[model samples]
Target: MATTLDISTTYYKSPLGLLRIGGTDTYISEISFIDHLEEGEYQANSLKGPVTPIVIQCIEQLIQYFQGQRRFFEFPVFQEGTEFQQRVWNELTAIPFGKTISYLDLSRRLGDTKAIRAAAAANGRNNIAIVVPCHRVIGSKRDLVGYAGGLWRKKWLLDHETKIQYGVQTLF
Candidate 1:
């Protein structure tokens, strides 16, 4: 018997936008802010089910993040990519809350300053949005750069986190 992979999906209505989360029960595979999920992911897989435990956990943590009650995510995220891309994602998690780092600096930390462009490319390919903290990355000049979810969303996330960390409230 050929067994199909067990994958599930759920929609999270976040302050930013509608998020489509897809993955297995044990780990989150892809989290996109857009309503549409790419092909061959949990959404397109043969076996579809209700939201898994990990997906529920991810949504809960995301709520906490937006509510300013959480700075780090603990859910297990399942992502398959090149080794360099994996390393880039791992480094993104280490970026402090409300803090931003440049792609050049990130590549430097990875021990290859010449790989800055490659690092940026990997950052753009990140599947897990807020959980992986890809929005925390910026241009070398401290300007906002590439973001799959859109530049406005990136700015909003930064502003939201910075405001909460600094203990300020705005009428947004």
Candidate 2:
């Protein structure tokens, strides 16, 4: 028999707005903004399982991240995806917090220059978001595109990180 899992959901306010953090017993499963998922909708789906201590740690790390006090996150996350996606997310985390890389560059780094679209798709499906750092991936032409959190939020995040990297005041 397959192992059954129970998931937990919690809402927290962040600079991006209200966010719904979801987790299974051992790892964080999702982190979606309220505006994107709406309230009570995901709750109806019955999260895959209960929140574990590691999941709680991920939540706390996210809290620190949004406060601009954390430059990197170290937390366990469980994402469901194909091998390609897993590879893409893994490479995404390797990107430093305040830097940007192009999708074509990522595709090349993956040793397949033609896999840009696949790379973008993998980035779009990233469940762990900021922790995975998929936002660091941009268009080959240095344009921001295809963010699950919306382009505006992507720009905000990049700009914020850039400001933080330069030690400048981050203000819209």
* Candidate achieving the largest lDDT: 1
Clashing pairs for predicted structure model 2, backbone only: 6-48, 6-49, 6-50, 7-48, 7-49, 7-50
List the candidates' TM-scores in order: 0.87, 0.85
Q: How far does residue 7 in candidate 1 sit from its true spot (Å)? A: 1.7
TM-score of 2: 0.85
lDDT (0-100) at residue 2 of candidate 2? 20
Q: Give all candidate RMSDs, comma-separated.
A: 4.4, 3.1
- Tens-digit per-residue lDDT, 1-172, candidate 2: 1233466766666788766777765667778755756466656643344556766787688778877888888777777899999899989988998888999988987889899899888988998778888889888678888898888888888888877788765422
Full-model lDDT, candidate 2: 0.78
> Candidate 2, which segments miss by more than 4 Å at Cα?
1-5, 36-51, 169-172
The 10-residue segment of model 2 with minimum total lDDT is 1-10
CA shift of 131, model 1, Å: 0.6
Q: Clash number for every model?
A: 0, 6
